[model samples]
Each structure stands twice: as C-alpha cells, then as structure tokens.
Target: PGKDKGKDMILLTKMDKRPPNWTFVFAVDVARSGSVSADYSVAIGIAYNSISQEKQICYFWRSKGLKISEQAEEIAEISKNFNHPYLLVEQNNMGQDMIDELTDKYNVNVEAITTGAHTTGKNIKKEELIRFLISAFEHEKITIPRGDEYSREQMSILEDELTKFCAIPTPAGNELFQGVGAHDDCVIALALANRATQTVGIPFAVTLGPGRTQAGGVYSALLQATRGESDIEKMIKLGIIK
Candidate 1:
C-alpha cells in the first residue's frame, strides 16, 4: 500500500518477495501517449484467498508517455517481481500491440478481455465491467490500501475519480461510462484486476483456519487503486466507498 512515485511511474510494494498462500493476478488498461488528453497506462496486481474471501490490491503501476513496447516491458518486469501472476489485458486501443509484444518478446501469458465490437470470444461491456467493480465495493468483497502519505493520496485520487464517474446517455441510446473531466484509466485497470479475482481459476487448495497450504506469498502491502463511474452520486451518498 506504499509507493515510490516517480515522474512517470508509481510502484507500490512492501517487499521484494511474494507472500504466502495467496493467488495473484495482474490486470492492465493500455493507453497511448503523446497527447495531453491521452489516458495513463495502468497495471494492477490483486491478491486473494479463495477460502477466506480475502481480496486486496497488492501492486500498482501507472505511467504516461510510455510507448507500447515500454509499457509491455514494464508490465513484464513488474509481473515477474510479483511471481508472474496471471495477466489480463483489455483489448482496446494499443492493447493488441501490447499483447503481441508481451507474448512474443517477453514470453508472458496474457488473457485478453474484449471491450470492443469485433471479438470472437466473450466481450466485457463497459456496464458489465463497472457493475462487477460496483458489486465488489457494495458487498465489501474487495479493499484498497490505506495509510502512508502516498497511499493516502492515491486512495483520495481514486475516490475522487469514483465520485466523478458518471453514466452519460449517448445518441444511440446507449450508455457511456465517463469520468466527467477526470481520468478513468485507474478505475478501469482496477476493475480488471478485481474481475480477475472473481473469474480466474485457482490452481491450489484453499481452506479456512490454520494449517491451510500456502501457494505463493505476496509483499505485505494493502490494496490501493480506483473505481469506475456510474451512479457514483448514489454510491457516494451511501458511504463514498473509501
């Protein structure tokens, strides 16, 4: 739940080694650079206990102005540090290129989450993705990190983004999830991670109480990240979701 925020990157980690008895996954949202309006490329690591139902964010990396190749490299490196958790990348914008690069160049395993019209597999609509995250928060099934200045500021920024996230009616009568002048990259990235905790298959046994087997360990870091926009006012009025 802590970070070393650089000019173009932020990595939050508690230790170099992985934690005990946790399954991990990395979810990414890709964005191109150069334009001021361009969104940030974000990758989040989520850790969970299948039995205890303990889900928390363990790592975060967000950067702007990085090329697709650089982003792929960074993701590969960070995932390696986290024991090479399952990688889920949204197939939008520079997503295909990033996926190609990571698989071909870095030998990384990636599951593509479809978010566009042209998909041979199941597509994750914006509403569905947002709803997944909303359910997680509403049910208190997931948590983000707190404490420390950088972590606190990150949480504040994420909460602010959630508060600003709104659903807009489009000309086609469809709905669009927007941050309404704010950035939703973090929210999307975090949602992707959260989804991983729910959908990905666990390879190890998970039981309650002591003597349960430990799969792989994680750094002792709290969950930290953002959420999507839609009926955010209602969510805020309920508790602000911090």
Candidate 2:
C-alpha cells in the first residue's frame, strides 16, 4: 500500500501517568520510504526505579504515508505534550534529514547519536543497546501497555512488529539483529530509546521543599494501570525486588 505521509498519518495511544522518578526519553531510527521497502517510527519509553530500572511503556508512531520531516514534527509535538522527552536521533544515511528538520527547522531539543565513534567515550554501543532491549524483555524489566479507547485496536499491531526480529550472521562472524519483515522500525526505535535512557542516567525523584515527602498511596494503582492486566506483584513475589 502506498500510503501518503500527510496530516492524517498520526498515532494516538493512552499512556500511564509518569511516576515520581520516571526518566522519559524519545529515540528515532530514521528512514525515508514511501512504500513498504522500509519503515520509520517514533518510539517512547519510560524508565523508573533507579535501583532496579524498570521500563514501563513501549509505544510507537509509524506511518507509510508520512515523510520523514512530517514524522519529525509529529514526534516533536508528542514529546512536548507528554513531558518533553530527551530526544535522540540516529544520524545515519537519511536519518540526518530527520535530525536537520527537528533541530534547524523546528528548533526543538534533540540529541544526535551514531554507532561507533559518534557515540564515543559514552560507552553507548549498538550491541549494548540491542542487548539491553533483549534483556529487558527476557528478564521482565520492560512492560508494554495494552492501550486504551484511543488506540485499543492498533496497539497490537505495534506489538506484533516486535515479534518479527531475527538475528542473522554477519561476514565478521558476529550476529546482526534486525527485523526480517519489510520493516522493523518499532524494534530499532525502541532499542534507541533504551540506549538514550541508559546513557543519560536514571532520573531521581526529588521533593519540593524541606520536610516534604513524596506520596506512594497511588503508586501501586498507577503501576496497575501501566502494567495493564499483568500481576506486577509477581516479580516481587519471586523476590526479584532490586
């Protein structure tokens, strides 16, 4: 399907309320494709609990109809409306176009990261990012939302994309990971999000003033809402509280 990247190409999904110490980050693995040759998505994730570091949300914005610049504007708007996430853009190939639009034209807050020396000294490696994502899912450090009335039906589509990831052998005798389907924009973008949040350090919750204490009365309820129907306490029951 040749979808047009127009104003109509947008995504809306319900997200949980940000917790006290939630570190919000937005990452982009940019691509320009009018058809299904490739796909691009804007992914959002939140990391909490500085000690344990649990990722609470995994949401994506992708459309075949919208141009890269259009997608950049959409991501900027979403980030601004939802607590201004720390933006990360991969400047490889056509990715620079997305970076230019977000920084030069829109003048938004964004950080550009590339593989190898581009992310030098920061110890941010693509392999590490992918490993972190895999670990998050396997170890139950990441929890995905089931969406709500706004995107109840479309949420599964996004989640389905995650299942298509495959690892292939590279000429260098190392395994390269990617989506085997026409597009793996969601997986790549989410990996970037995890990397961004990881390198930036976990945001800690601070009080307003002296003697002021943070409220935990509704924390559990918020987690329930974020975790959907999952028994979040199972992790605690298993003595995995870190």
Query: Best by lDDT, which number?
Result: 1
Lowest-sum lDDT 10-residue window in model 1: 218-227
lDDT of 2 by residue, 1-242 (tens): 11121112223343346556666667877765645455655455554444677665545666656677677788777676656667888776667788788888777678877755333553345654555565454455555544344343554554555655555557876646666667767767877776676656753222333222233334334433543222223223332221
Q: For candidate 1, give the lDDT.
A: 0.67
Q: After superposition, how far is residue 20 of candidate 1 from its true place, in Å?
A: 6.3
Model 2: lDDT of residue 158: 46
RMSD values, in order shown: 9.9, 12.2
Model 2 global lDDT (CA atoms, 0 to 1):
0.57
Assess each prediction's global lDDT (C-alpha) against the native: 0.67, 0.57
The reply for model 2, stretches above 4 Å from the true place, is 1-19, 34-38, 116-125, 147-152, 202-242
Those runs of model 1 whose alpha carbons end farther than 4 Å from true positions after fitting are: 1-21, 33-37, 117-120, 169-174, 201-230
* Model 1 lDDT per residue over 1-242, tens place: 11322223223563234356568878999985535468888887877767665566667777888888888889988877776778899987788899999999998878888875432364766665765666556545556666456766676666677767776767986667777754888889888887777666442223332222222222101111122235555555544243
